[model samples]
Target: MSRRPHQIAILGTGYVGLGTAALLAHLGHHVTGIDVDVCKIEQLQRAEIPIYEPGLEKLLLSNTSQLTWTTDFSAVQQADTIFICVGTPPSADGTPDLQFLQTAVASLAPYLGRKQQIIVNKSTVPIGTGDLVVRLLEDLAPEFDASVHYVVSNPEFLREGSALEDSLYPDRIVLGGLDTALDHMISVYAPLIEQSFTPPASAPRPERYTRPAVVRTTLQSAEMIKYAANAFLALKVSFANEIAGLCEHVGADIEEVTTGIGLDSRIGHRFLQAGLGWGGSCFGKDTQGLISAGREHAYAMPILQAAIDVNARQRQMVINKLLRHLRTMKGKRIGVLGMAFKPNTDDLRDAPAYTLIQRLAELGAVVTAHDPVAMARAEREWSHLKYSSAVNAAQVFQRADAVIIATEWDEYRQLDWEALVATMRRPLIIDSRNLLRHPLTAQVEQVGRELKGTIGAAL
Candidate 1:
């Protein structure tokens, strides 16, 4: 590890920006997190985290001396490396809207110093976005020497729940840039690339990991890597759900089938669990961006398109299962088990639970939801639905006719099923996530298959 720390500025305080800021600070770099949201900046200035990510707050607090939070863009002038971590949300046509990226670049143009600096894109963006950024910067700062400024695409692959660990012990660090920008980007992540930094106390180094490999490639290929990786994972999940649907029709247990197929060396099990389809800030948008990018090039990405279709169908499958069990959802109280996309984070962007709740509401099913961490955000976002505290899961069960396990939180798996069954009016457990064992009820329906015959029959 280099004894001299690089001055780093991270744009945007969302998951990727804040996590990267904290992790870099923890790695002994002087980091300044810049965001346009005044409230978010204020919150971070007060040592408060606006988002829920495990170990993030502690990491921020522990490295407060090395980290700075502000809405000031001037910080970029002093930084040796600037990371653009702003959101590239999907537009109406499913293309990544680079408005934020463009705005960030334009704002930083005037402050770009004559000294050589690397501007890295840490956001998941379209393949040609790096070229776009370079052009935009050139147009914005024609007076500034172009040779001193370099644009690089270093897309992030951080998962929300375990973002800190993922950033610290990543599978790989991908840098897409010309040779001129490569050395600065590599130096910025040298600690992580070489595994020389001490792991944060909150998230220790994992036993099954080694130093992450660094893959240096052209800007376009590196951009495609981010999209392709996410699209492939989404495909795996949708494929699993498709198989689960077949398992139900043929009376085959999805668990057994997945287990058997997962044992195959080539088809190792990771995203093979059939459940409510993927939702978060990344998968859906990145997949959509990839599809839209292909369309622009007159190329067809049928596999990626089908993956999106299958994911949407999986949510509908859950709805169909509910309708089959209740005959009609009209006036029935359905207790939704989780609201967030997945466990350990409060992010509800594109969560499958939102789709299910909307459909259930249209069917006149009164929805009551619960999540260990996302209930407050859910309440703020979807005020029409009812929410129960985590401690009041039994209360929700008692009031509802059926319980739907939407998000597979670890706490949901450890729920007192017997107590919940006793409380439910109908004792119907719709395990969309397939996270539960055989409940003590005859009316247990899951995504893969349903146990309709007996209470303790094959699950």
Candidate 2:
């Protein structure tokens, strides 16, 4: 295995791409991030990350000398390992769209130097995408030494908020490609292999037990593993929501029920916190892609499809809860506590809060929403609704007839519930995440207020 430092280029400097570039550079590799957005490149060049990731900026600033962000494709010519981290948006029929992946392959063709470079698909793509990308590269650069270009399916498993941690200490790193390239790719991750350095910056470092082994599987299996992991997590949330609904009817507290079930080692609670639903970039898209992949292979992935269907209903369930309270949303003023899907990041791509806010507006409710980072994105997506910071937006709740705890941000959890409720016209609080059910929920109920849980009716 060669120990030579590789020149790596990460295409698409979004969350996955930027995190990958930062972590790789921190491991002492030469990394250049490329994207068509020059303004983003300019921001990154100045050591400013365009997005809000917890520890990403620190790593980006620390590795600026080795990490470069640019709009030029010339960088592609010098890269020993180029990761295609561009988006593979879902098609109208819910299948994975390969247009961006294909476009990236075409763009890299003209710059195929004689050097053998591993062109890795770091993007979350469908199974057999490795073969498709490899074929596309060959057709596009037939005149060049096509044999030098190798395609690998190295899917990213980073979450939006904690991408850095997940990258550094990934539960497992699944590298998929031709058998010939496996050893070389393993050598590239030697720092992690030898335990010389830590995992990516996104995952939480273990406090006691030994680290989980990084599994190397076949490309198709590796691709399937990514989808399967996300699908299961989504399923867990949907399952929790389904149980929460059952708990409401049976007079069982979901918090206590989830805690009891979570105590079991196998079902060790992580995504079991029942909320409006799972809403992020991965779960929805990957589950659909997996179902599409199953159809392509003439297999039925009914279980995964049910998880997707359950998640969709979970979001609507929150709207229904809100409707049950006000009876008619017409002329109602609704205040949303959190707007981003999950707190800490400003990514509002598929946040459930948006769905609830939209539904409220459609039903003639005047909605005012607040989120720490996602306000700009939400403003763009839902132009009609009012966006305010948690501080100033206190007025929205002050005059609001009802308040919906949509995102369950830590900031929202720490809010002075008594004071905040004092501002509201009706002082009604809906704990969509059961976030306040503990000491806070008990405290609020003692204050003679009408509070509702995701599944339970208002008190």
Candidate 3:
């Protein structure tokens, strides 16, 4: 945290690593990014970003003077602060596989102790990973003086689509480890903690944005905070979906119910919109990781498991609605709108749309899907699902048997639904995201409403 600008090295170039590099560079820190992907590093070297994230390219390109990308580990020795941003993908049992983390740290070990270093863990890891990293550093680099290096956990809470905005203006920043290690990170995030940096025009600060607080804790507690926050958000979405199912049975409007409850100060209107269940890198992995931790302690995490169950069934809600109307999926040409897990990201990891598409294909339905950003990645990754792909939104609507709104993109909401329905073979619209405020003459089938009420309809 030198005021005159300090050199920092980031060990991964994924969303979190690259975004942190850009954010830090914006604050006048020189950042060097190291990664194993040859193509990705080459892209960065040419001022290109491999992934599709809004404003990330602009931010990185604009601050070229402060950034560097390389595949060399020797470059890390020049920086006093190094951040481990490698991936921790889940294993079969939901425990985070630390293979990538181990490799990065091992490569990093041989070069440490050359200077006074503050090594920060920015990867989403299991609760006790800090201690494990500390052990690895000592064991792998026994020749280096351990006193010159310090390990700390500084977890990131960046959401994919709005990562730039979220990082620029976050709610809080957590730094966990020994008290001695706390000051170094606190100083590192001083600009963000104080909200003193000049805002980027592309992502100006919101009028009501709050300054971030730097929360200090032990290593495991800091790690747990990352998991707990994502788990609770996942639970909230599932809770709303759970209630949406109940609303259909009780003849209540879900939007009305959610709005009513959201007015309460305690229950703010953030993740309460009833639609498809949660999907992304964080929620499922973190929740399952927490449950796996529970298993280690011999305590069954009934609530989290229930949240997961409720979320899984939400996919069925769309299927059940299709069955209720079409009676069978055999030979039907179903057009699905929106395929990404959510909008503004190409990441299809655990997307709710894929599960629905797979189910439709299994029942012998001819499916064609469209998304604003995720279509290319989806075409490459989801070819086995055997569904047709559409880049033009109108192609999805043309001669389609039915349309299911999967990913809530703003452009999907602005389509002329009345005109588009006329082109479809059957004008059935399954509004999964609670999109389309206007009704479609009883032909459009919206989820969580008008689906069930009396036992006669249930039967």
**Residue 244 of model 1, lDDT score:** 88
Clashing pairs in 3: none
Candidate 2 runs further than 4 Å off: 142-146, 198-205, 209-212, 384-393, 438-459
TM-score of 1: 0.95
Best by lDDT: 3
Give candidate 3's whole-model lDDT.
0.87
lDDT of 1 by residue, 192-251 (tens): 888889887888999988899889999999999999999989988989989988888899
Candidate 2 per-residue lDDT, tens place, 1-459, comes to 456677898889888888888878877789989998888899888877888888888778877788878888879888888889898888999998889888888887778788788888888888888888777877887545556667778888788787776777667778887765676677777665554665444444656535536677778888888888888898898888788777777777677778899999999989987767888788999999989988988999998888888788877776776666679889988888787778778887788887887788788888777787777666677676543445444655778888888876777666666666667777666767766733322223211112344522222
lDDT of 3 by residue, 35-79 (tens): 989999999999878888999999999999999899999887888
Better of 1 and 2 by TM-score: 1
Candidate 1 error regions (>4 Å): 384-391, 450-459
lDDT, each prediction:
0.85, 0.76, 0.87
Which of candidates 1 and 2 is the stronger one according to lDDT?
A: 1
Work out the TM-score per prediction. 0.95, 0.91, 0.95
